[model samples]
Target: MEATETVLCSLLAVDLTDYCYRVCSRCQRVLPSDNNGLASSSFCNFCKSKEPKLLYRILMSIATDTSVKTVICFDRAATVLFGCSADEFFHFTKLNPLAASMVNQVFDGEMLRMTLTRPHNRNAQHMRVTSIVPLRSGFQPAIVTLTHICTKNASLGNCSTTNHTLRKGRAVVLDDPNEETQTALVADPNQEKSQKKGMILPFKPLTMTFHNVNYYVDMPKEMRSQGVPETRLQLLSNVSGVFSPGVLTALVGSSGAGKTTLMDVLAGRKTGGYTEGDIRISGHPNEQTFARISGYVEQNDIHSPQVTVEESLWFSASLCLPKEISKEQKKVGMDEFYLIWLRYG
Candidate 1:
């Protein structure tokens, strides 16, 4: 409401709506959708409450009501939410001024803030996308939806503050309107005297640089050392290649030559250095589907040797699969062998 004054529309402070953000069609304002209703000048009851919180609640409700099914968020978290770093996404796909607008518009045109990192025991990277999208039902009304997507490709860097705020489901705001988290922030010092004004930095993707086991432990200390040259030993040396669902791929290598990194990537673990290429769980790739379709199996045994192999695998399966089932699942298949025992290496 504090932008330029014009008689074309009345700008008012919007606090009642939980999904307090919207992209104006004509002017493309990232302000609250007070009256962004398709119809003239009227904001309905649904638009008032059916925003980010309500949409997520409804989606969860539907997922539970159907008990037999699963759900997902519908788009890649990286491109959808981190388009603010259109410069970086340029490394993946080129973005022109118009294409940038198109990409951002479909993604609700709000600034994208995202982060990607590898898990400790897994190979794949975790990318967190935080942006607001609009959910609609024909011409009825439109409400904002808060979306978060984690994906493959690479570990994200530059998203510490954002990740902290998102983990708690809140946005970080500064007390001093003119103070900056860093000098890069554009704050009008003169305006601090005339009331206060804060500039909004569109969200960007934070990268996580993952490292291999041998070098990963010493990375933090190494990065802190002065006068050391930056090297590609981490970024270009990814051993955890990408994988597709239902496709049979093999990660063949010497015992210590990084086969496990390949396996970890497919499992979606958060490794801090190497880049993860891509991940697709089931046919529908979205934020929500990740929780269900994505499951991992470590090679080590979690059961005692006294227990039979069938009993052990069954126990592991029960952790993810249904607890109640017919006796047909009782069957067992043994295919255990160590790398050194085989002659492939």
Candidate 2:
């Protein structure tokens, strides 16, 4: 009965009550706990080490159109689902008590691609989730989701004070009860003004210049057999261009004129061809850093037809922007992008 299967399913529910377990660090066996539910200091007969480590083990329900299954996931697959290591997530949950609920909220109804393994025994009760991958491009990590939840909760006047002790045995205070209300009462004029003017992206203006750019690919064997002496077929030759900031640049050419090839070389998207050129970004030689500042869309790129334009923009902003940015700011950026598209697209 040993079989493995892959399926596309929606995560219906998660149970976090017993989401983790303590294991012997050396032998990786389940460790016993005392009456208070704390790890015991008893010696391990397997490896004779007393150290214990926590590992994530999650129980979740996944469903397709008709059938549903209960799956057990170990640490590696659990990390992929939560987007953080087990120890880190444990510490985060301790610091923010709302994190567990927030995680469930974020993952509820999320689509996932999962690999499931059936046990060799015919009477096994649950399938094992060997791997997990989020199908949504805008999937947020557990920490990010928790932070957003905490911020939203605070804004809604649901803050509380808690005292915590650090690993160094120092006492720390978190979230004064009056802090949120006091901050809400006082508004920053500069922030308001900036909001009215719309958010500015954190990017400096850059210009790209290329001179004598040429591209070549290996000549096919069929052509070489036909008595062609050259071993390489040149696609572009001595092409020069400059694209400045805040300018519209268009490459116009008939089919087979190498317009797409030239753009691919400039954008560093060519995978199998040899390129020769002096391509510079703002007077500096173009390197891997160019990928961080530039974007290229292929002619055959496709998106989900079921998703609307606004939904696509929001998803892109959520995925591409740094986690430090607030959800409100992301919404604002999405609105701005929608307006630009309406005007130019």
Candidate 3:
């Protein structure tokens, strides 16, 4: 058997036996058990509490693909996994059977990197699951934070060799792939070397700026055919702003304020709208290439209810991800998408 200070292992199975134990919430000590092998009281002998609150800790067995299994206990990683505290999880399981079932699904078939320490007994090694990492199949969550896990806030941006900027007084549609298909985002010269050294550098962020942006829908041709004068409906007028990188900008307005219409025009989703003014990315006119890396979710639930969540994510990843990404990588990306949706949906 191989022995090391740190072991990167995939979870083969989780032992649900003695999965949970009750402890005094104040003193953080295990409480007495009743005849049924369930926690009898929340009282702690060490602290001597008249009325005690209780909490639970989860313990499970984890292993590599072909190695001997070892027992590991959850700490803050429990909260990270389920995005809730242990007390909350206990209450959730008691209240929501479906949510408890969902929690159970996470234990098996997960990959983690563990740091190992040998006890005085020396026969078996104990390990703590320190951090989650990508599995051999490249399945890894794209964005995880203390507040949220597996969020869609992160996405791939389009790569272009030739830089384009927004020109003044231009309202050009950016979905024409034929015009900029030859260019791809060039990789940084240091990225390869850094990856080889097991470090990944963050990509450069793009800054989008739109000035005096306006959109109008022309009157129907049939309406103009009669003596009626041709007129256009202005959806957005003289909207100017810079969406700088690393800044949270909210587009707040009353109904019919054209917030949605402005977004549609920027995303190239408006087919019949006439646009004016300039939309620049990093001081250059944005072209069709920018659309390659852009992602947009409709405000309404327009997808079919019959389609499963997995199918929907797979469809999106297939279309949005770069062609160079392999099918296996895309599958991993979809796994991440599913995890995020489960928490946020």
Best by TM-score: 2
RMSD of candidate 1 to the true fold?
22.8
Is candidate 1 or 2 superior in lDDT?
2
Cα lDDT tens digits, model 1, 132-163, are 23222121111111111111101232111112
Per-residue lDDT of candidate 3, residues 249-299 (tens digit): 698986678888988888888878689987765445778777776788778
- Candidate 3 Cα errors over 4 Å, as ranges: 1-202, 220-230, 302-345
Ranking of candidates on TM-score, top first: 2, 3, 1
Give candidate 1's total backbone clashes: 28
Cα RMSD for candidates in order: 22.8, 22.3, 26.1
- After aligning candidate 2 to the native by TM-score, how far in Å is the CA of 279 from where it should be? 60
Query: Best lDDT goes to which candidate?
Result: 2
The local distance difference test score of each candidate is: 0.29, 0.66, 0.52
Of the pair 2 and 3, which is ahead by lDDT? 2
Error of 1 at 233 (Å): 4.8
TM-score of each: 0.21, 0.38, 0.30
lDDT of 2 at 127: 86
What TM-score would you give candidate 3 relative to the actual structure? 0.30
